[model samples]
Target: MGLGKQDRTKAREELAHDQERAERLPELLRSVAEAERALDEARERGALVEEVHEQGVRLDTALTEAMRAAYARERVLVGVGGYTDRIRRRKRLARPEIKQATQVAEHLLTVREAHRLHGIQQAPRSVV
Candidate 1:
């Protein structure tokens, strides 16, 4: 009903997906291992050249998929409000930019001091 509840529901749904992937990861790993073994056996037997190539391709594809699933499982969120690992970009400032910023700041300070002095000069004086 509320935005906060919606956020929590989304987070829980994501966690459930991750958990499902994790549950299937073991089976995927086994499949990859079996494919590798089959490919090796085909190679050892000197089977048809096309068959060997096909087996090798299958093994490679399975291995890649299994690894991806494992990585996704490992990166799953831990808690409801925890932060996810993310890539951050560093802010780089050129020399010219830094110099211009410093000049602007100095100008602002000078203007502020001038305004303060002006205010002091304009204040009503006490009568003797």
Candidate 2:
């Protein structure tokens, strides 16, 4: 059977919420970019560990929100390959600044790639 009235209403509300988030995707991306930049600068400047951690947290939160919104819009899984391993490798190199910056940059790159892939997936396919 089809959805009942309450279920239909809930579905409609969810759809509308997703649509709103989709509309804000651009803004969210900008915020993520800004956060990434701030984190990178903090790391590069040899800021205190606590300061760098704060900036990293900000970037992480922004990336997470952006990904959530993108998923809501596209309903697809985006793979960021080997992120943990890459971070571990960087950490093992003993370059704290580079490791921190790389961690933030990697996340930002993954989010951008997710958006790009979603766009490609949503593109209209041609018929022969």
Candidate 3:
């Protein structure tokens, strides 16, 4: 009923879709492999020309790309799920608490202007 719940549900749904895409990717790869094998066999038997094999190779490449795309979709879904978790954690943190926590040691430094302040540690960036 709430926005948070809705967001969480959407993220979960995306995650499920991503998992399904990941699972299907291997099957698509197998189909490409089978096509490649068939092309090779045809070439050996002289039933098909080089052009036929080339077409098969193109199809294989397309399928490989499709698999990559599917995997990427899955990653996006998983990232959404991670985003949902991050949002929940952020929601619980008070604004003032975050502001205080975000301050760096460098900001507190009463620098001895004459002396090189080498020992003061810097704050770790959120991304790092």
Candidate 4:
């Protein structure tokens, strides 16, 4: 027995919905890309490590949830078995860099202030 016309139409509509979501994949990927670039610049500029890590972790969590949602909606949206690892890697890669940079920047700022104070102390005392 063949699927009734109505059943075939329903299947077609479902496929169409899935395909539309697939079209939205590029936009979603672009969002992740923008976040990555901002993260890199933040690391280079000495943004707070714990804070950056928190944000990155949040993004990673969100992206994973998104991938999971898409997968549940359309399992073929991503490659078989490779869908869950991308965000995890991004999170791991970003945490260390931010931590290192923020620590270095904080140390440098402290050293600068110390040196500035020392220079002030050693300056010849002028008569009032």
Candidate 5:
């Protein structure tokens, strides 16, 4: 059967609604794109923080190992004058390595904190 006048009016109304939604498609797409970009940035920041922390841990471990070696060298030199000089030279060499490791670990911690703050700042706010 052919559509009655009421049916025809309902069909026109539905078509208009669909057209309106289609017109809003670009805006919706842009919003989705922005959300995705924000998510990507947050992930990148988190990764950077993790990387920095790992580096700090590695540096700390190296410093610990170097100190252990220096202590062992000192203990072995207890009462010999000639060997005491060798121990001093070994300690002097280890001192720079320890210092460098300490500096690098501190710097990495600072970098991690900065990245964490950046991630928090970039967090997307709800539109509600």
Candidate 6:
């Protein structure tokens, strides 16, 4: 069956949105990279725990947004491919970005764990 007018309109809108997102992918990736660098620098400088945590949060948000943009860009690519082929292509396109994000996340987790340990060490011990 042919698509209804409303369906066609919605599809067009979605395509347009995906195209915009594809155009923005580079900027989003740059933001993610910048946030990751800032977080790394904060850790290296031994900044306040709160400051490091804030940086980590920023990195997390940037990474999430960049990932969404990447997925959107992938969706916008039209070609002759089976489902598995498309899935493989998407994974290939995303692998590097995913690796970078994973590294940042792991580093943030380590920093958080260290902070938690430090807090525990600073807490006063009560004698039973």
- True-vs-predicted CA distance for residue 56, candidate 6, Å: 0.6
Clashing pairs in 2: none
Rank by lDDT, descending? 6, 2, 1, 3, 4, 5
Best by TM-score: 6
In order, candidate lDDTs are 0.54, 0.58, 0.49, 0.48, 0.44, 0.61
Predicted structure 4: lDDT = 0.48
Q: Looking at candidate 2, what is the lDDT of residue 9? A: 67
Per-prediction TM-score? 0.52, 0.58, 0.40, 0.39, 0.35, 0.61
TM-score quality measure for candidate 3:
0.40
**Which candidate number has the best lDDT?**
6
lDDT tens digits, residue span 1-128, model 1: 23476677876787677667756667877886798688788878877766776776666566555655554454342333322212211121224543454443354345335534431122234489
lDDT of 6 by residue, 74-100 (tens): 555532221225465556545666455
Ranking by TM-score: 6, 2, 1, 3, 4, 5
Whole-model alpha-carbon lDDT for candidate 2? 0.58
Candidate 6: RMSD to truth: 8.3
Put down candidate 5 lDDT per residue, 25-117, tens digits, no spaces: 345435534544554554567655444444444434333333333333333222122232455545654565545544444554554455444
Where is the poorest 10-residue window by lDDT in model 1? 83-92
- Expressed as tens digits, the lDDT of each residue in 42-89 for candidate 4 is 667877766456546544543543443343334333222223346543
lDDT of 6: 0.61
Off by over 4 Å in 4: 4-7, 61-128
Local error of candidate 4 at 15, Å? 1.2
lDDT, candidate 2, 18-117, per-residue tens: 6677567678889988987887888788877677667766766777777666654442111121222345444444555545434444565586566444
Candidate 3 CA-lDDT value: 0.49
The reply for model 2, stretches above 4 Å from the true place, is 75-128
What lDDT score goes with residue 44 in model 5? 62
